[model samples]
Target: MFLTFFEPPADGWHVRRDDLLDRLSREWPDARLVPSAEMGKSEMRDVGWTYDSSEETVECWSAQSGDGISLDGDEGMVVQFVSWFRRLVPREIDVTFCDDMYSFSLMIPPGSSPGDVLRMYSETA
Candidate 1:
């Protein structure tokens, strides 16, 4: 449902998976990271989704569908979730998806909130 992109610092600083998970849990109590299956050594790794049952939302599919962060629920909930997610990323980051050319591949640049970016995407779609 959601994929986060960021240019690592010159010194190679990157987000720790545990730290990210803790932050997500703190900010959105309902959000859970569900792991995906890896069939063989050739299978893609580090795949999962952020699921929030209370809002019926999912983000970052494990299959690398590349939709960045996706929201599935009522418009209001989607809007809310996007906003919530935007708060966690630094300004240098670009939280986006690039799989669906027609409607889901926008590289939401910095400055605009994720909610605003998604709103624009929805309108254009």
Candidate 2:
């Protein structure tokens, strides 16, 4: 699965870059950051940093007004990432989750359990 964060039209996003980096470091200590030059040469668009581990990747991208995180890994790891992510960003940030067959968006409120989100997705998608 993939998850992205973006500001609503004409609104400010609540994601703090420093906090995000710190959390990522804590969560994936073994991941290595792919250099900016390498990122530029890759197929990704507007990606700030791409952190890679043996079995997974976390790509960070930025747009005019917001940041995005794309996570690719096993289902358990993805869910764990989402649980931490939901607690990292403040309430009301626009989040989009996508998979090969489904793409869905929601404003996941602060304190919304990851399990709840998963259940909701299963019901809807």
Candidate 3:
């Protein structure tokens, strides 16, 4: 599964991709950026999203994209990422959880709290 984060336009909560990736790499050595190339494969639909971000600027990360990470690590990784993000960004950000197969997708609104996100994630689980 993948948990993608999008910065709302002019929200002042813009997330710098390089900074985020750097931090994530340090904080979670196993974490890495999802290559734009890999995102095109049919298996990428496993995130369950009906939309394609190939033409847009979206930041996607995988909790199960090898390198010692696995799908089972999504929950903890997501929770940590959200918690860490909330600390740095006071404004709202949009988050999406989906499969590479496009079989399931859930969007967590910017208005949602961490608890709410967890609940939604549980539903998908």
Specify the highest-lDDT model's number. 2
> TM-score ranking from best to worst?
2, 1, 3
lDDT head-to-head 1 vs 3, winner = 1
- RMSD of candidates 1 onward, in order: 4.9, 4.1, 10.7
What is the Cα root-mean-square deviation between model 1 and the actual structure? 4.9
Summarize candidate 1's per-residue lDDT along 2-111 as a digit string, tens digits: 33344455655444555555766687676656645432232433434455555455553222322234444445455555555455556666665433333355555556
- Per-residue error for 110 in candidate 1, Å, reads 4.4
Off by over 4 Å in 3: 7-14, 21-74, 82-93, 111-114
Candidate-wise lDDT, in order: 0.49, 0.57, 0.45
Q: Between 1 and 2, whose lDDT is larger?
A: 2
- The full ranking of all candidates by lDDT, starting with the best, is 2, 1, 3
Candidate 3 TM-score versus the reference: 0.40
TM-score against native, each model = 0.55, 0.59, 0.40
13, model 1: CA deviation in Å?
A: 3.1
CA deviation > 4 Å runs, candidate 2: 8-11, 37-66, 100-102
lDDT of 3 at 112: 60
